[model samples]
Target: MAFLAQFRAAPNLLTMVRLFTIPFIVIEILDGNFGVAFALFILAGISDGFDGLLARWLDQKTTLGLYLDPIADKLLLSTLFLVLTHVGIIPRYVTVLVFSRDFGILLIATLLFATHTLRDFRPSLFGKLNTLVQIVALLTILGEKAFSSHQFTTLNATLVRSIAFLAPLSAAQYAWIVIQRLHSAEDPPRRSAPKTGLAQISAVEGADPSGSTDRVAS
Candidate 1:
C-alpha cells in the first residue's frame, strides 16, 4: 500500500537528507577533519529528531519513512563505528560488539521477513538505549579529538563500556521477543477487531525508531 501524499512530506525529506549526509561525514572523519565531522554528526542528529516529530505533527507518516528512518540510522552509525575503529578512535572490541548486535538483529529480521513470520518491527527498549548510548559515545569521541578535552576522554571511556554491555543484551532481548512472538503465533486469533487509525498512529508515535511494527502504514 502506497501513501503517495506522504511521499513528499517534510519529515521524509529530512530523513533522506540525513541519509545523504552519511558519506560526507565518513569522509570528513577519515580525513582527520574531526571538527567538520562532529558538526555534521550534530546536524544529522537534529535532522533525525525533527523528521519523526514533523511526521507526527504533520500527520504524514508513511511506511517508506518508517522503514527509511531506521535504515539510515543503522547505516550511519554502523559505518561510523567501523571507520572510527580503523583510525583507533573507538576500540576494536566495542566495534565488534556493535557490529555483532546489529548484524544479529538484521539477520533475524531478514529470516522473519523471508518466512513472513514478522510484520512491523517493534524496537525493544534495550535497542533504543543501545543506540542512544552509541550516539553519545560517538559524539564524545569526535568532540574530544576536535577539542582535545580531558572531560570527553573520561566520558568516552564510560560510554564505550556502557555500549559494550548494552549491545549484547539488546540483541538477546530482541531474540527473546521474536521467540515469544513465534510461540504466540500458535494461539488462536483474538476476538477483537483490527486496530483503528488513531490507535495505529498512537502506537507509531509512541514507538521507538528501532525497528518495524506489526501493522504496516496505510
Candidate 2:
C-alpha cells in the first residue's frame, strides 16, 4: 500500500501518463505515422515538464519519483532513438554513442553502489545539455517527416552532429566527477594539532553544557 501510495502524487501520476504514451508513440513511429508520433512525443515532453513543476509546487517529490522520472525519460528517448535508427531517420552512429554512454554510466553507477564508494548520482551540467540536444534532434526529425520539409535537413544534421559531440563529452565529464568524488571519499581527514595548555584552558572556559570544548582538543 505504501509503495503504491507513492504513485498517487500528481507529479508521479503525470510521469505514469508519460510512460503510457511511449508504447503508442512507438506504434505510431513503426507504422510511419510521423504526424501522430510527433504529437504524442510533444505530449510526452509537456508531461515531463509539468511533472517536475508539480513536484515542486505541490511538495510531492518522493524518492520513487527521483528514480522513476529519469528512468521514464531514458526509456522513452532511448527506445525512440533505436526505433528511429531502424527506420534510417536517425543515424546509427548517434544511437550507438548515446547507448554507449548511458550503458557505461549505468555500469559505473552500479559498481559504485555495490561497493559503497559513492552514492551521489546527480546528473552533471553536460549530461543535462546532452539530453536536451537529443530531445531537439528527435523533435527535428519528427517535425521534418510530419511536415515533409527539406529545410529541416540542415538543422537536423547540425543537431545530430551536436549529439555526437555532446554524448562523449558528457560521459567524460561524468567519469571525471566520479573519479574526483572517489578520491575525496578515500582521502583521510586532516587532524588538528593538539591544543596547548593555555588554549585548552580557554576552550574549557568557553565550553558549552554539552562539552563541545572536546572538539578543540585535537
Candidate 3:
C-alpha cells in the first residue's frame, strides 16, 4: 500500500519526522554537540509517544502505520546505540550485549513469522522495561555530555550497567513467551466467524457489477 494512503495521518507523519531527525542527531553527536543532540533526541521521543496516542485518538490506524511506527523506533534507538558506542561514550561491552539481544529477538521473530506460527505481535513486560531503561540511559548520556554534571555521569554509568543486566533478561522473557504461545496445543481451536445467508446476499447486492440497486428493464 502506498504511504500516500496514510501520509496525511498525523501519527504516521510524526513517525516519518522522527526518522528524518536521525541524521541530524547523528551529525550533532559526531560533532561533539551534545546539547543539540539531546534536544533532538527529546523531540524524537515526544513524537514517538504522540504518534501512538494521536493514532488512537484520530482512529487512523493503518497497516502501514502499524508497521512503520515500530520500524522507526527500532531504527532510531539501534542507530544511536551503535553510534554512541563508536564515539566511546557507551562501553563497547554494553553495546555488544544490547546488540546481541536485539538481533536475537529479531531473528526468532522472523523465523516464527515465516513459519506462520504466530500472528499476534505483542510486547512483553520485560521488553517494555528494557526500553524504558534504554531511553533513560540515552538521555543520561546526552545530559552528562551536554551539561558536564557529576550527577549525569553517575546516572549514565548506572543506567548502562542496568541495561547490561536487563537487555538479555528482556530477550529471554520475550523468547519464553513466544515459545509458550507457539506450543499452546491445549488451547481451543479458533472458530471462523459465521457468514450467514443474509450476509451473503447483502455482499452480492452491494457489489453488483452494474453498480445499480434499482431494477432495470431487460
Clashes of each: 6, 0, 0
Please, what are the lDDT tens digits per residue for candidate 1 over residues 1-218? Answer: 35776558888899989999999988998899999999999999999999989988988788889888899999999999999999988889999998999888899999899889897679999999999999889988988888867887777889999999999999999999999988898788779667676665557576434544444456
lDDT of 2 by residue, 76-157 (tens): 9999999999998889999999999999999999999999888889899999999998999999899999989888899999
Encode model 3's per-residue lDDT on 83-144: one tens digit a residue.
99999999999989888998998888888788887767698998898889999899888988
Error of 3 at 12 (Å): 0.4
- Which lDDT value does model 3 have at 115? 83
Worst 10 residues of 3 by lDDT: 207-216
What are the lDDT scores of the predictions, listed in order? Answer: 0.88, 0.92, 0.87
Q: Model 1 off-target regions past 4 Å?
A: 1-7, 188-218
For model 1, name the residue pairs that clash: 120-212, 120-213, 120-214, 121-211, 121-212, 121-213
* Model 1 TM-score relative to the real fold: 0.81
Ranking by lDDT: 2, 1, 3
Model 2 residue-pair collision total: 0
Alpha-carbon TM-score of each model against the true structure = 0.81, 0.88, 0.82
Residue 8 shift from truth in candidate 2, angstroms: 1.9
